[model samples]
Target: MTTRKDYTRPLDIKHGRVDMGHGAGGRAAAQLIEEVFVKAFDNPYLRQGNDGAALAIPAGHRLVMATDAHVVSPLFFPGGDVGCLSVHGTINDVAMCGARPLYLTASFILEEGFPLAELKRIVDSMAAAAREAGVPVVTGDTKVVEKGKGDGVFISTTGLGVVPQGVDVGGANARPGDVILLSGTIGDHGVAVLSKRESLEFETTIASDTAALHTLVAAMLEAAPGGVRVLRDPTRGGLATTLNEIARQSGVGMLLDEAAIPVLPQVDAACELLGLDPLYVANEGKLVAVCAPEATEVVLAAMRAHPRGAAAVRIGSVTEDPHHFVQMATRFGGRRVVDWLSGEQLPRIC
Candidate 1:
């Protein structure tokens, strides 16, 4: 089905915007794919030009997969955008299961008049993130919706990874006396998105902590094989809600040290001005890892060794309680039970 006409011209990536014809499965579509997506995310598997990618899985390894859809408002933010967020979110999800992300697939839904320049920026961001994570976008799809019917753009990403043997980490594995560790500061991503969405200018700006956490997870596993009990990236509901979910699943209670948990000063000020609790705000780049007490130092050391988790520290411990509640010891030397967020704190945050 080679055609001379389809190759007559190249896409106008500089000034053109996506049109309905780009998604119509015609010559326009082919040209768009050839010029934009393929050019940005060129790899051997993607170059195969097949409907599905053929991946050679390693023997004696179990496959782990996760999918996430990103609909964040203000596509471009301080730290990242929908493109990198799409890749990082799903990669973190797979890594939370103690897997090493290997490949990714992304699908895009574009509005009629979405700028091609913005699309190129997003695509380039995604390609860079995937390459940095050592994962390739092997296959993908693109669709267009009418103006006013859809947001500027929406990205859905799916990732595949391989879980090593003798490594079992999940929400239901935490037990009493297990130590809890946090990867980095809390509420950076949520605060960054909020400031951008509301056009609020703080004295100091905050950036989203969106990042791929598989490498950090890999380091922790290397430090202590089978020592990590549960690993979760606190995203939507923040650290409190994530801990609650794990406690309920593991049928145990949690105790957190408020003084030990990290929070950026700018983020603290933003939350104070907005009357928001940092614990309930979202975080895209941080994770909650519960491990055995004996291996806590080793895991913490390993986490601190990675650039993504340089500020990682032990923040809490698990306890025996029939009620499976998450409690926090305040900096004021008082204890308060940390409950779930009443409702959505920040909406449209990835």
Candidate 2:
């Protein structure tokens, strides 16, 4: 067992700054882990330390893995921060495949002058999120770069999960005649972050829908276990880009009802003010699911039953077309192409 020599020495978590030595794979690095990473995410797999984790997985289930990097501008945001977002983002990615997210590994790149109090807050939030999601941050790495060379802080997380028997879901599985469903309202996460940055005042403040979706996925699986063909969380490019990706991947076209798509009144107002389309705006806690037409009601019910997907609705359907175009029936009873976003609408808003 390794023990701190001077456990009595207080950690400079108030005003201390990081230095290159922190990433030099020496005493500074060990100290950082001992005082921060390990302390926040204490688990058995990390204690082993053999370059990567070794685990015993159950039989008859396929393993699923996903990785994502977090670099949102404000380390803290209206509803969530880099910490919880990192965990939720990766977990959602894994859950998108109808898998049960079980473990995670986090890597941090911290700038030299970043505040230790802020770091502690972020880590504590991350631990809480992981605990609430029932997934453990089992292993992690920390590296500190010199001031000005890096952002205040960036986090990269890798998630591992298991896909139960008879569960098959992916972008390539979307097929014609399948119904498309959204977990909840769109553009909340992007609008919330933007409001915080621009200091915009609103009658009803928008909050980022940053949350883990595995439980919702589990509920969906229980409702229509094998009927779900594809599941994706519309994040960076929002629903439009994500749907287009699925269309291209599955070689199918999509038709959406503009009136059927759910959007919060505040989000719509915010997008109008910013000259942005809510469809192109990012979302952190919503999922777009493609399921058999017969299973649409079942899936929608499951999604609505989950707190994260309380506003769930059936928004569209897949069609047989080689062009793989996504069209929307406008509110005025007209149809228009919902093409891919031309340029970045709101970068770093995720």
Candidate 3:
């Protein structure tokens, strides 16, 4: 066998483009992973340099896992890019299950001829987000597709968490008398991406509310251990669709106060201008929670105390309806059924 020679120069991160060799599982592949991924997402588990991470799950705790794929167009947006969004998206999914997010795994699909500078920027952003959230990317895979066969980049992330004993949260746990709570204003994310994508200008800029919510979930769970019944992050389908899903699952109905649901003035305006409904728009950092009526005050207080949920409010309640519909009492003294969004409202929105 012949000995392999070391590279004479480092990767041209500033002016290079990814080639097929970077994903060939040879010298180029090893070099790319070592310089880009391993250097940025440095951690004990990742430093092991193994095919998979060996995580030590906490004793007596239940395990939870969630995965999300981000394909948002124009990779870069007003407030965030696909990088941080991928991390926040997966972490929020795990948190919505009432678990404490512990670790993350990232996978990248790079198109041939993609600029190395953009790739490095995205990786750095993902690293910063993971550090801020106290979670680390442990293991990941990289693949390259032929030019014109794929987009610039696509990221897929998976999060692993552990739920403490005595906590049970699920969509089916909602009851007829439970109260529904929203974390903050909706439609900010969808509008932010839309404005950037369509070049629609507004007096004020709309930014994506991409963030990790495990800490907020922890706070609410601590405040009412067994009182919280359901937790969900409204992503693709927005608030109305999410509520409809829960209503169907629990065999109940929801009655919402249109006035109580918070919507930023700019977001509402942007929706009106674009012929869109804010209720059908997406939100990245917001959450919908259902808790027993007796625990409403405590849960609301706890949610408001957290920065992520500072604007939390009681928006509605579960009701008995054989039709399992989600109805909203309009601020104008009329009621309307918040039906499921008809066709894809906004495609590739995370």
Model 3's alpha-carbon lDDT is 0.92
TM-score of 2: 0.95
Worst 10 residues of 1 by lDDT: 1-10
Question: Candidate 1 — what's its lDDT?
Answer: 0.92
Backbone N/Cα/C clashes per model? 0, 0, 0
* Pairs that collide, model 1: none
Error of 2 at 278 (Å): 0.5
- The segments of candidate 2 whose C-alpha lies over 4 angstroms from its true place after superposition are 1-8
Off by over 4 Å in 1: 1-8
Candidate 2 residues 76-189, lDDT tens each? 888999999999999999999889999999999999878878888899899899989989998888888879889888999999999988899999999999999999899999
Q: Please write out the lDDT profile of model 1 over residues 1-350, one tens digit for every residue.
A: 33233334777789888888777778788888888899999999889998888988889899998999999988999999998999899999999999999999999999988999999999999999999889999999999888888898899999999998889999999999999999999999999999999999999889999999999999999999889999999999899999999999999999999999999999999999999999999998899999999999999999999998999989999999899999999999999999998789988898
State the C-alpha lDDT per candidate: 0.92, 0.89, 0.92
